[model samples]
Target: MSWLVTGGAGYIGSHVVRAFIEQGITPIVVDDLSSGHREFVPDGVDFVEGQVQDTSLLERTMREHDVEGVMHIAGYKYAGVSVARPLHTYSQNVQGTAAVLEAMQRVGVSRIVFSSSAAVYGTPDVDLVTEDQPTAPESPYGQSKLIGEWLLADQARALELTDGATPLQHVSLRYFNVVGSGTDEVYDTSPHNLFPLVIEALIEGRTPRINGTDYPTPDGTCVRDYVHVADLATSHVAAATAMAEGRELRPVYNLGSGDGLSVREIMDAMQRGTGHTFEPVIGERRPGDPARIVANGDAAARDLDWRMRHSIDDMVTSAWQARTAHPDISE
Candidate 1:
């Protein structure tokens, strides 16, 4: 049986697709290509180009492919942009997730792995965030993700209450800042993400800028948890494997490194990795910029084999190499 991967042509989703294939599981991709690239979907994989909100299309794909599970990753991911486009964000993320669940119910698919975000925590109160941390999402994107998690929980509970219904086995992986490429075939292309912004600036012979430098932290810049996309993909596959094998798993897990790197530190890494020595420009802090937010991943480490297999240098170098490899796409 194959697993349906929504947004499988995107960066992190593409990595998850590759991980599934490496583990001998067939993956069928459904992506709208709004923010994702079609070429990112590996050759030989069955791909359907359509919106996740297309319930009939998803149902047909699930039935045709004999899908056993779903990896729901397609959504409007920009937190700042979501503030200006709340309706569009809700339509794509909240409604999109509902459509996926609806199709799953119709097809008797009982497993799912949700792509959640640490934005659910907003500006976390503590240095180390855990699954138990209070959720106070600050943007439509974050709220939509939290709502998506709720949808999965509610659906699972409803299934448990139904007689003769296959109970839904699901897990939501909350991620922080995801960077690096699992393979040179796909790289981070988000214009809003820090890594890509910096890498793109360097490639275009422009100096990267730091948004906030007066925040309370070493080097006076925002600090955030950064994890390799490949490591994140590994844990996603592990979650899918555990569920398929009837092993118990948590309802949600944070895919994060306990430690964080400051913006200045990241700039230094960019300089070292890319052989560019220009200092970054300091810009006014973006509204709602937090001082720091890192997550404790002990639970994920124990249950999902989550670990920071790549160092900061590894992340920078790989991202640079991958971005440089696709110069035509760089903006």
Candidate 2:
């Protein structure tokens, strides 16, 4: 079946694309290449170099490829940036998602897999967050995603003008800390996340920036669950397969490793994995960063029969390998 994967050349999107390809599925990629690298997109897959908000372009791509479904990974995801530039985040994330939904309806493509975030449940009272947990989005980034989710629902039910009841079903996967790399061909270009920033700092012989050293956690740093990209990729396959088999309604699932690891633990793991002794500088906290946020991914496992096979060590090691192999994230 033909599928459209927005941001398919990006880190997580590429993994999903590769996983789909391995299962004898052909996916067309739509990436504007703003933050995503072109090298991540494999040869032979249909690739559209454009943005999700480009409605005419999206319609053309879907029509040309006969796209049956869409996997929307196209969004601005930096929490700090979202705080600084709320309008831009909403425009790119919320508005872009709406456009994708409209284009999907116009093209008669039904299913979508949304890449949501654990940040939606910002600073949960408990570390392990379930999908039913209250949404208290801390930043515009998270709020925009929440808005996107609402838009997805509206699109599915055909509640708006230009409207007709759509067969469009969506599965929003709220994931946390997508780390590790299956291909050395693609490494993270943005150094916002903990893993890549730490690895790059070590390679450059500089101290890594560890935000907020005064959290209530054991190590006094914000704790998070880091899920391996490969494992998360498997779950994406599960989502696609579930929809392809005809799940009637839209569902949301949380993807996580079901554990919490602190910044100290992450530093130690990176040091061990990269054989580097670089320490991180504990600066002031990043604005809108929650104290501790982990995932209670039992719902996904229960529904999709998905489980994480890679450990935290595996995530660090794989990321370390890629950083060591290509320190600059270049081909």
Give the poorly placed runs of model 1, Cα more than 4 Å off: none
Worst-scoring 10-residue span by lDDT in model 2 = 158-167
**Total clashes in model 1, counting residue pairs 3 or more apart in sequence or in different chains:** 0
lDDT of 1 by residue, 1-331 (tens): 5899999999989999999999999999999998889889999999999999999999999999999999999998988778889999999999999999999999999999999999999988898999999999888888999999999999999999999999999999998789998788899989889999998888888989999799989889999999999999999999999998999999999988999999999999989999999888999877545678899999999999999999999999999898888877644
Clashing pairs in 1: none
Scored by lDDT, the top model is 1
Please, what is the whole-model Cα lDDT of each candidate in the order they appear?
0.93, 0.83
Error of 1 at 94 (Å): 0.4
How much is 132 displaced in model 1, in angstroms? Answer: 0.9
- Candidate 1, residue 62: Cα displacement in angstroms equals 0.4
